[model samples]
Target: MSVTPHVVPGQYREVSDANGRVYRVGETDRSLLGRPRAWMVWLPWIAMMGVSVYEYGYSSAEAVLEHAHGWTLTETFWIASIWAVFQAGVAFPAGRLRETGVLPARTAMLAGAVFSGLGFLALSHLSNPYVVIAGYSVLGGTGAGLVYATCINMVGKWYPDNKGARTGFVNGGFAYGTLPLIFVFNYWFHPSNYKMVLDLIALGMVLVVAFCGMFFRDPPKSWWPHDVDPLNRGVSEDARRVAKRLAKNPPAKGQFTPMEAIRTGQLPLMWFALVCIGGVSLFGINFQVPFAKSLGFGPLVAASSAGVLAVVNGVGRAIVGWLSDYLGRRQTLGLVLVVAGLAQFGVLWSGQAHNEPLFLIFAFLNGFGGGAFYPLFAALTPDYFGENNNAQNYGLVYSAKLVGGVGGGGVAAGVVAAWGYAGAYYLAGGIAFLSALITVFLRQPGAPRRSGDGSPVAEVGGRTPSPAEATT
Candidate 1:
């Protein structure tokens, strides 16, 4: 008996046999969209951000301690750098673990939250600097790494089409978390009972951890919203056929391993871009508070400025996210780097003048530049590589920022000690300018497609049909 094949409109594919009956191959309305389980995924991120904000209080405390206990600048720098190192080291492996499915996203998130709480709790009681460094820097850094990697990975998966926007939203949460803590710590702490402040931080971490644990969940593959269907349709049949015919087939679904990604040229280029941006941004964020203080601003003013910077940072991420969806990734990134370079130099000029309004403008511009870079890096990775290994890829790329945190922060402190704050500002501005130069070398990974149009339709086992035929 002979058989014939017929394609139906928005329904099952019909293959007819000589007997006059048909068999279906493709589903009529199988959903292709990916929706996350209701808001549960976001909770873990929000909790982690809260803990990060609480951790910033320690820096605020450091400023206080400098005056109260006569702690040296070296001591403060070491504490912060050590913490950044710990976060850098742990983030990649934690990402690898999540990518391999050894730990569920929620479970890892809970562990991070709990560990951070305990670290803060230890900080509250310790009198020795070594113990404070070990408990808060090392332990807290590890926990932060875990929480950050997992939250970013989940968000990337949840919004496959708009990785930048989703990651920007998550990063923004970290910034927002700082606002509340600024008020809380100021209202709660007293000059006489310094130890009580640590206890309060520990309590806050515990509550955040518990709330995250209760609510967080890894989005199931089937959870995508129905409305997003048009975006996630798998590659064209022709592409799949070509992929299948290759000597080495594309990695299995959810099987693009991290080890393989590192070997590709794309990874190194991506890493370089991240390092350039991360290095400059971290230096600015870590030193902005101290720099403000050195310029004759009181602790209250300095701390308040940091809080404002945090808000501006969040706004930067959101703006970049929206821009990435419209402009190709590489072009948008190049533009951001250019703006950041200008802002960094602006800071140099503003710091020397000692003009308040000019200083604030430069500060906000600098914040906008540094803040916007991270979300772009986060979104760029999965767009180049498939989502299968998103956690590991992002983790590896994120290490650049961690390195920047240490190098940039350390360099700024050393420069400030020798040349004064003006010199340090000049040095950072140079680095930001260099980073912008590097951005021009980066290119989009794939060919250009229609603007703001994500879906690319192709024919099954044949050339892509015309749009008129595709619609019919």
Candidate 2:
């Protein structure tokens, strides 16, 4: 529980391996940040929740937004779809900027706060769809992207030794954070009062992001926790727990540059899987409420379905993330995809049958399956590729969401118009199943290949390599 300052300021007893990857060891979180590393987790979690309303709660206000702006249903949905596009599209650029020192975390957060606030202002006052798209979709999505990328990175960087649960906890905040707003948009918001409410929400988002970001700081590159041995499996109790994790979900074989990661063929697979799963997740978020309403559900049922989705979506991330620690990332991910795929069909059948209780039950399963994959991919990127270039590496992987946003939102709406909800739900469910299949092919890049004798055959070195040494 107590950490003695072992490394002097600005210096570390660096450790290196055959791959030239360096770890700046011997610094405790308290020594570097003047607080426990847990602060990093909480701050990012709160900030993630602050911007969550942009995605998770936006659906509830669609009808009001359409009436106030004199837009059609499709137009309002496009706003959300476009918002998702920019929101996800900005991750790669933002990650590049953050990792290269071109934009510090604090500065990124401040800029996000300003832009996010303006995005709502644009939505509040602008009636023209194009202008609103530029302001709300582009600016607002970018703001959310910056915060989202930074928060996830912060958690991963601080807790590399055990990031699954921590990353999941922070990532979950992005979904459920919109719970209160979902109800407000459904019950209290109308065209007459929408502007005032949105303006207030914008201001609150700005304050939360800016305040939490003020304390944001990245640890020195390749920083490892002082108590955990980055190489040897220590005999200490903490080290033993870490060893167990390593056995299940080992760290990267070596630090991989973005291009290197791409060359390994694993990065592309990860991207494709994210695209598939993310589209399914976004489809649920955008359509669940509308689908309920279309099925002749009451106002409360419609809103409650969305609220339930948001809550389960968020909480499931944390639960599955923690579970992944012991269960192995690949196995847990496969399970999540399978469960989500089945739930999609369940939702469709229940809705068609007009079974409200059954519908709600499937909605719970749908919500759980919807948001859990995000944290897994977030953690898996660094798990497969070392954390040094993780911001940019994960950026590349997370960018799939841009395409997913379009597919799940605008493209999905078109599918609905053609085939109705039945066809669209079927497509989304199929995509989840495909992603689950992809999970079967995922293996740690550069890890030793088994020989005919069933012994580890060296792939990169003359002997069986440690998990972190296999990639190079």
lDDT score for candidate 1 against the true structure: 0.62
Error of 2 at 151 (Å): 0.5
Relative to the true structure, candidate 1 reaches a TM of: 0.78
lDDT of 1 by residue, 1-472 (tens): 1111232333322222222212222322222212334353366457656666533445455665554445577677666777777776777888778766788777887778777777776556664668867887788888777777777777766655356666777866666566666655545455566667766766777677667766544533322222222222336574343333221211112223466566556667778777767767766777777777678866566666666666777778777876776675666777878777787778667766776667777777877787788777787777666565777777887887667767666665787789886776667677777777776775434322234743434342244545653442
- Tens-digit lDDT track for model 2 on 379-407? 99999988878899999999999989998
Point out the worst 10-residue segment of candidate 1 by lDDT: 246-255
- The top-ranked prediction according to lDDT is 2
Look at candidate 2 and tell me the lDDT of residue 229: 74
Residue 66 accuracy (lDDT) in model 2: 87
How close is each model in CA RMSD to the real structure? Answer: 9.4, 5.8
lDDT of 2: 0.88
